[model samples]
Target: MNHKEINSFYTYLQSQQTSQRFLYQCYKKIDGIDAEAKSYENCTVFMYYLDHGIKFYNAGKKLDILMQPILFFYGMVHLLKACLLTKRPNYPESTSVLAHGVSARKRKKKDYTFLEDEVKVQHNGLFPYVSQHLFFIHKMPFEKIMMKNLLGLIPDLSHLFHFNNQESMINVSKIGSHTIDFTSRVLDNYHLTERAFLERIKPYLPPIVEVKSNHTMFQIVLTKPILEPSGPFFVDDNQNIFFPTIRENFLVVSEVMVHYLLLYNLSMLSRYEAEWWGDLLITKPDVDYPFIAEFLRISAKKMPLLIGKELLKMK
Candidate 1:
């Protein structure tokens, strides 16, 4: 497609209100064409469609479908954002806060022993109701980067794994907000089933107990279960297997699939709720509220289906 056609396509997508099926058809048609035929100017346009398709699949109500697409979309967005933001400067600044207190000389250091107590009190406060969005956007990236690195180390799969390939598959895992993303590019490039890929690299996977304390906790608590039934399997550089446990590993995989389904349902519900919330917010931005709260709520709701489709291709 030419630049004009690309622009027209984007404009049409932006303007048309339709069911997800219609949008999917459009994506299938565009994706079927050769990228080489498109002009440089149309590249961004094509990317936008790809991005949109991902968003749709991710927000869908089906976890099974949402898994791969979300990963792929995330990878694409990560690559795009990295390209655009890498050289951009970020400024650092701090805010000042007012202090509260009592008199000077009479207030001995012992009197301030309560300061430690007060600090403890503050720490105890607000430990629960943490923001999920912040956790997903900020904390999850580091974990994902690590997972990507682990997948990268999978010997034979390493050649097929391109961390920087924008179009690569083996997109995100949907086990949880923190699950590893896989993209279709990985599957397509490797030409292997997920099970086959895992089995091939089983010999190289690090021992479960060998991982560091901090990393081990998260992996054990959050990630290991999902990958269970597959193995307590560990790989040496020489491709030797350590743990031969089988039944437990399979159970873990089953649990992982359940978690993925939960996340998928949550994403769908959140998106549906966000649409109504967005309408309400649009009519009243006068209220003192964070736009990001609304933005994330809406975005989360809409992403599952789009991301799901991209992931389904991996299978």
Candidate 2:
């Protein structure tokens, strides 16, 4: 607003190590997609080039433990959506959002509906009958023979491990919702819901962590240590601000600001990470198994925990 204010803000920015350093890096990459970048042949290689911090500066410290469990379960949720009905990225005659009667079960041939549950089950698992009656029979040789004779009988459960179809990846909603502890879910028999999980890690979180959701939301007061997954350095604020959160980290910070007489600004989000909260799809038409014989090995109970453990190990 005024010359004094402008100078003060600049000086305050210079004071923050993480914010100032990351903001500059983001500006260079603001040019958008790195088209000159090479096409990746594998997810590992692709993920390598897509390294979260590599585009900017490699973050000097380890990222928090909470990030992957949140994202993997989120991505896995997309897989569940795929099972709800037979969906295609584009259709035979025209392309739009429609699920076909590809479901081999005698259940509704064509079902159209959308759901937003913090669930961790396969598409078939969504059905009461499939999860209840078939719970034990699904494991028998009879079910295997049925799959051969019936065709498409087991949509989601039969192919739980297949990761080849890009269209099958989860579709992400652009905007988001706010919740204090949204990750927690209590299945009838299971006990390891996300809310319970966060509680396990609560002792490790510093007072800087205000809320935990899609991103770690931070409450910036005049002088609290604000830890962002973004980049290096954090700035001290002169004023009190509130409700600063991260989509990437599922963390929420509130009561944040800079300056009593001074001024400051903190950028929202670091390098965009779609995998954190988005769905999974198999972009390429043909890569590996078009069929899902391997899916039988996965049970509803074996999921989220199975995959969640692996994702955490990668971090």
Backbone clash numbers for all candidates listed: 48, 46
Q: After superposition, how far is residue 6 of candidate 1 from its true place, in Å?
A: 26
In model 1, which regions exceed 4 Å deviation?
1-250, 254-259, 271-315
Candidate achieving the largest TM-score: 1
Cα lDDT tens digits for candidate 2, 95-186 = 22222111222221122111111111122332222222212223322221122212112223222323432111111111121212222221
TM, every model: 0.17, 0.16
Q: Which stretches of candidate 2 lie over 4 Å from their true place?
A: 1-179, 186-190, 193-196, 208-226, 229-283, 287-315
lDDT of 1 by residue, 75-173 (tens): 333322211211111101111111111111222242222112111101111110011111121221111111222222222222233333422122222
RMSD of each: 22.1, 23.3
Question: Native-vs-model 2 lDDT?
Answer: 0.23
What is the TM-score of candidate 1?
A: 0.17
Candidate 1, which ten residues in sequence have the lowest lDDT sum? 120-129
In model 2, what is the error at residue 192, expressed in angstroms? 2.6
